[model samples]
Target: MTVRERLMYIAKNRYARRIPLTSRLKAVLRAYLHERGVIDNDNLFISVENKILGARSIQDRLRQYGNLTGVNNEVTVSPNAFRRTFCRLKVEAGTNIFVSQRLTGHQSLEILRRYVEIYGKDLEEAIEKGFEGL
Candidate 1:
């Protein structure tokens, strides 16, 4: 896709909303695309029949990989779980909630808050940091 087209894709507010890729992720994606000979503007991922992969297909693939890697043995591995973990990690890493909301495409802070799983240690750390200059 052209640079303008990619920017428009990122600005679009839809289920297929695109996010900015990290440099590492960009390199990995470039390598994968090169390996797959996918130089066109087609979908990044596709099914065996060359069709776009749906959400269920993606989740099924995650589950399959999780099972193969023994990650599903302790907990369920799904896209929603990844989303929650992403939000939680962003919060724990001190990313602004509004930034996380924008990144996650969350329409409301209330909904985004539900995805952040804070712990007692996090609370203690927050308290300590809050009192650091006092």
Candidate 2:
């Protein structure tokens, strides 16, 4: 599913109030929830205020867990990496840079662009595949 869809689903299942929701947004959320099932009550991806598992505490535990499970030189756990991953996925999916910046809560598109990079293999493969089709 798309990032926008995931965000809407998270907002919906967690927000049980009578808050407003766009019809299009509700449709996307319904599809995501139907596909993924409701996340575990204690899953560490939701917010604490929502009485669900969340990222803040999970991040702290991730650091400790990384140190324990990862090689000494490879042990690093960063919340920003998740943001970077989101940015990369959006860019690869043809999301505009401006939109990615807004979704990522970045102050500038310049900063957002720095998070995304064109992959050499993907570019090369596209050229090779085009030649094959020709």
Give the C-alpha lDDT of model 2: 0.65
Best by TM-score: 1
Candidate 2 segments exceeding 4 Å error? 1-58, 65-77
**Per-residue lDDT of model 2, residues 63-112, tens digit only:** 77777877435634666766687799988889887877766666677777
lDDT of 1 by residue, 11-105 (tens): 22455665666667678877987787754448888766778887788889999999999999988899889889999999888999899998888
- Error in Å for residue 78 of model 1: 0.7
Candidate 1, residue 85: Cα displacement in angstroms equals 0.7
- Candidate 1 colliding pairs: none
Candidate 1 similarity to native, TM-score: 0.74
TM-scores, all candidates, are 0.74, 0.47
Residue 57 in candidate 2, Cα distance off native in Å: 5.6
Q: Each candidate's lDDT (Cα)?
A: 0.79, 0.65
